[model samples]
Target: MHDFDFVRPQTVSDAVRALATPDAQALSGGQTLLPAMKVRLAAPAVLVSLMHIPDMVFVRADGDVLRVGGATTHAQVAREAAGAYPALASLAARIGDPAVRSRGTIGGSLANNDPSACYPAGVLASNATIVTDRREIGADDFFQGMFTTALEEGEIVVEVRFPIPDAARYEKFIQPASRFPLTAAFVARHSGGARVAITGASESGVFRWHEAEVALTSDFAVQALDGLAVDADGMIADLHGSSAYRAHLAGVMTRRAVAAIV
Candidate 1:
């Protein structure tokens, strides 16, 4: 990779101050960023590591919401979050491989907002809050599009607050080689209603399937999804799968998630 200065600060304030330097980028797990740097897809004059900051790496259950530190690794969540949100823990446990799970941070994944990433689906469906150094952003408003978010330049994700639901499930159909979801659904059932989020299939990125949510919220059963069809117009189409196939999977996965919850 290109030459760059690296700094590991012990506090959020220190890290934020370091990031104020021009051309500096925040480094969390480096699962995505380091690979890009290796390929010259991304280059920064300075790398500010957030993992060194103690406040940015933790998992805590706060009443009905689970507060997860932004720098918390997937493995930690997979282990620590089961008591608060089992479905989310299950999702974390299946992301990529052991190495990727150990190094990748939730903050990095949400910040990058990769369309195929699993966390966005969970966060969105759970109606979680994305807390940053600047302000808190609702999940509905946080994800802008594929690889895009509402975060301004130099903003840091501090933590995510996920409101635990009455019941929840995430079903993912993954590409064998990459282990990234080709199509996935996360369903969360609350007292008021249900929320459904789909990922890995949308050309526009992760989105809520309102029809399924309404149906599931009304019935909370697999049979409730009958007659529901996902439109393929805006789905991702490539060598791996067709837009039609992905759209079909979106519906199928949502049914599976709801079935699991039921």
Candidate 2:
């Protein structure tokens, strides 16, 4: 890793200020960033640590929303959020291994927006809100693409608000080595409608499976998806699997999620 100045800020405002410096990057759990730095894939001049900010590391229920701090660790969520959102808790429990779970933060996960990440599917399917230092962004508007987000420079994610769904489940075909999703699906049933989000398969990044959502919303059954087919043209194709195979897996996972929920 390259030499860098480190600043641990006590407040969100101070953290923002520290990150305003040139080549300064916000450090959450350092799960992804540290690995990248070691490989020389990333080299920042300054590392602004948010670990000291108390308010940015919590899990609470607010009316209909399950609010999770940006700096909240995956392990924290897995342990603390089960009553309010079991599906989310289950997803958090399955992320990477115990060490990665203890260190990886939701803010880092969403900010990094890894195409194969599990969080984006849950966030999108739940129609959560990404709260930042500057403003709140709807999940639909938050994720732009793989490794991209709507957050501007120096804007730090404070917390995320997820509307508690009536029923929800996330299913993933794990890429064994990395523990990342080979093809994952999160199905959520809300008062408004049913929402389905697929991750780790699309070339455009995590995306809503509209046809599955439409079918599941009406019937809420595994058999509801029998005829629905996922288009393979936009799926990610590589050594792991072909685009067609991933697309097939996307459909299968969606069925599994719906089955688990209903």
Candidate 3:
């Protein structure tokens, strides 16, 4: 790993200032960043730690939304959000192993925006808001592509606000080695409508399966998806599975998620 200056900031403003240093990068959990650094995939001049910022670590329900601080760990979400949003909690619980769960933060996950990561599906399906130090970005606009997001330099994610759905569930077909989803689906039904988000299968990144959403919105049942199918053209094809295979799993996982909620 390259030598880098490390700064632990106690406040969001301090962290932002620290990030202004040349080639500086924000550090939260260090689950993905650290690994990249070791392989020389990333070489930042400085590391601005957000873990020390108090306001970046919290979980609470504000009226209709479940507000989760950006620095809050996956384990924290698993424990704190279960009562208010069980589907989110369940997704958090299943991310990586206990060690990763304890260290990985929701903000880090979203900011990193790994195509196979679990949180994006939940955020997109729930139509959550990604609150940054500068402004609030809807999940639809936040994710750009694999390992990409709308976050700008020196910006920091403060928290995420998820609208509580009447019923929601996430289902994933895991790749045994990394525990990342090979194909995953998150289905959320609200008073307004039903939304379906799929991850792990798309080459472009996590995306909504609109046809299934429309079908399920009209009839909230697993059988409603019986005739529906996900197109293979946009799916990621690798050693674990072919594009068609992952596309099939997307439908299967979506069906399972709907079944769980129904």
lDDT (10s digit) by residue, model 3, range 1-262: 9999999999998998899989999999999999999999999999999998999999998888999999999999999999999999999999999999999999999999999999999999999999999899999999899888999998899999999999999998999899999999999998988999999999989999999989888999999888899999989999999999999999999999998888
Q: How accurate is candidate 3 locally (lDDT)?
A: 0.95
Q: After best superposition, candidate 1 residue 218: deviation in angstroms?
A: 1.4
What are the TM-scores, per candidate, against the unseen true structure? 0.99, 0.98, 0.99
How many pairs collide in each candidate, listed in order? 0, 0, 0
- Taking all chains together, the TM-score of candidate 3 against the true structure is 0.99
Per-residue alpha-carbon lDDT of candidate 1 for residues 28-143, written as tens digits (9 for 90 to 100):
99999999999999999999999988898999999999999999999999999999999999999999999999999999999999999999999999999999998999999999
Cα RMSD of all models vs. native, in order, equals 0.7, 0.8, 0.7
Q: What TM-score quantifies how close candidate 1 is to the native fold?
A: 0.99
